[model samples]
Target: MTRQHVLRFYVALIAALTLGVLGVGVVGVTYLSSQTLIRNLFPAALLIAVSWYGSQRRVLVSESDIWLMGTVGYIATLVLLPFPLAVLAVAASKGLAEATLLAKKQRHSWKGVTVNAGGTILGVAVGGGVFASLNGVSYLWSHQLDSVFALPLLLVMILLYNVTNELVVVGAITLTSQENPWSVFWRLSRAALIPEISLALVGIVFAVLYHSSPIMAAFIVVPVMFSLRAFESVATLRRETVEAVLRMAEHLDFRDTSTYEHSQRLADLTRRLASALELTPEHVEEIVLASRVHDLGKIGISNEILLKQGPLSEEEGDIMRKHPVIGAEILDSYSMFKSSVSIVRHHHERWDGKGYPEGLSGDHIPLGARIIAVADSFDAMTADRPYRKGLSVDDAVERLKAGMGTQYDPKLCAIFIQILMEEGIYAPSEAVPGELHLIAGGRASGGRAS
Candidate 1:
């Protein structure tokens, strides 16, 4: 079963166990107590059961009105009897009801299984613990049946039970959902535990001061439930934004054959080079992103020229060169892409001021752009093209080193070669001529002057 299903099962089992235990405890206490104690304990147990059911419903609906109504009903019933049994009965009832509702709802909407299961488990544990503690305290205080430590011990037990429930629910959700356990734990805790625990703490402090006021304690559960809803909404939005960006990248890949693995390889190479050069994580991410989208302007190029097997004529070459400009323009139009425009536009620029478009040389080029230039060249040479076989990794490193200070920055070239060596790409039979083979090697083969 899915994580949600397992969570639901656990919540239901806890609820059932709580009710069963409470019922048996109340029955045995009634059998052993005087008539007055039995009368008092039975009503208190009923009240606790009802409260448990109401709290469970509140968890699923997550509506303040339902929770308030449930709490009010529990209080009204408890006040009418002012008996420990009545309170226990109400709490257990609420727990059972909430667990059932969660199971039913999860059956319909399985996508929210993790959230549902987590909330349900936590809700039941919290509600059950509160009910049990209140019952224990009332019996101890009213009947003088226990020591001063009894109520405090019960409270600790309740807290431990709630914590265990949270862990189990979080674990089941992670396993079933195939999500990282830590991530699931954090997310569920932020959505459920943080708010609930905050309110519970307030209630605990209030109870310590007032001496077991169930009515007052019930008031804090409302806002905690609301906080859970808010956290879930935020998490959902963040997930959607991430998915949207990935989809956009996928769409871009569909437009060009060369783009299929280009961005990924470029990103990898750029990250390696960035690390070799001792750049920080922030700088590495920027360089990697820039490398991935460096040729984004090529989207504007016609398929006719993009897929051409032979060398382009002068006019076509000129048009092809305009892609960087087109890419820069496109990036400049988006506020989010502004920083990447330089890399897209200047990746073609050489170190000696002989590159295309702006012909920016040396330090004039943006560092990110220069890094992308090296990565893009490396990837392009090693990747197979329609008219050319992919160069070996060794030859590619050799070409990168051969072009240092002429077409590429010498320092960057050194780092790039170091990265290749470190990544085991510089081994014999794997190396290729890289950018030098694509540019200089081509010119040399044709007997053309540089």
Candidate 2:
């Protein structure tokens, strides 16, 4: 099915399930006393609303996993309110909070609102219904000694709620991206497992505190939200630092005669090839960043060597070969760039142990480095330099095929070539036989090595 059709069906299914759950909840509606309304119900709803607002102050741990506060509010709401009230409170609080916090363009469309609300409702309904059915709600609602035994049930509810909520959201992502649902689910689950469990425990704490004194719960939840926002600020600053480094790398393009925007183009290609290989989003992001700074060590090379128009002498070649090591050292100074260091340091490493600062071969080379090598060579071969005209796309493809398992990973080369062909970027008919002309030293001057 088409992506849109899949998304539509999935969203419709969530909406239907939400309506059915609400219908079941309506049949068992129990009126709250004035004291109960003032003490538990009102406090639960307000806590959820506050928590929802706090949840918006989040940090993105990965492309798919967003870590946030406010599970405390949802769990507390389920603990203190009836099944129908808990579901409605979570939906209303979250939807309203997002509406208030998010910009118009960020919301995408009203369908997003429906999916989010429906998903939360299903999560709370399923988890709360299960807890109440098992007679664990009484222990949770009252500050009783028996609450110790009910803790396990609360854990189960949190697990069910998180799993149900995550499944609903991951289902939408899978449908829209046409990705394997289990893969998407696993990535999201693994990324958020610790934080989700921790937050669920916090929610249970807040619920227990409320049973004793609502004012005490309020004091606790507020500080927790502020702590979350503080963490969000730190994450934002780190991201800005990373962006600043990327900008610096881009500026370095001006330092060379034949390598302008070379890193940028490689980064673009790396993203496509990495994603095509079904790598995780975080892995794709890391490789793309690594490709952008793969040649960062070149800053240490002399201007004459960097801008040389012909093949280098043995001595000059040795100096040029030090760049990958130099680049890795430059990045190693910064903890944020730790992940990219190996990739930058080893991008020149060959598949058959013939290339590099290190003579690592085959699977010994880091996967990110291997991916960057193919992207680097392709960009270099297709790009015009001071000494020679760039090869045609077909010629570059031919070169890549010829180098497979020697200069590049055979599997990666094959995959990259297929991607180029499918994208219509390489036209075989336009290729000329002499386009693969060798310069002195059996290498194309100012090409891949540059």
By lDDT, who's the top model here?
Answer: 2
Q: Please provide, for model 2 over 101-209, each residue's C-alpha lDDT reduced to its tens digit, 9 standing for 90 to 100.
A: 5564556656666677777778888888899888888775556787677888988898888889888878776655444677668756765666677777767777777
Candidate no. 2 TM-score:
0.64
| Top of the candidates by TM-score | 2
| Root-mean-square deviation per candidate | 16.8, 8.5
Estimate every model's Cα lDDT from 0 to 1: 0.57, 0.73
CA deviation > 4 Å runs, candidate 2: 30-41, 60-66, 101-103, 141-144, 233-260, 269-287, 293-378, 392-450
Q: What's each prediction's TM-score?
A: 0.43, 0.64
Q: Candidate 1 on 124-143: residue-level lDDT in tens?
A: 44544464546644543463
Q: What's the CA error at residue 200 for candidate 2, in Å?
A: 3.0
lDDT score, residue 198, model 1? 40
Task: Quickly count the clashes in candidate 1.
Answer: 54
Q: Tell me the spans in candidate 1 whose CA falls farther than 4 Å from its real position.
A: 1-246, 428-450
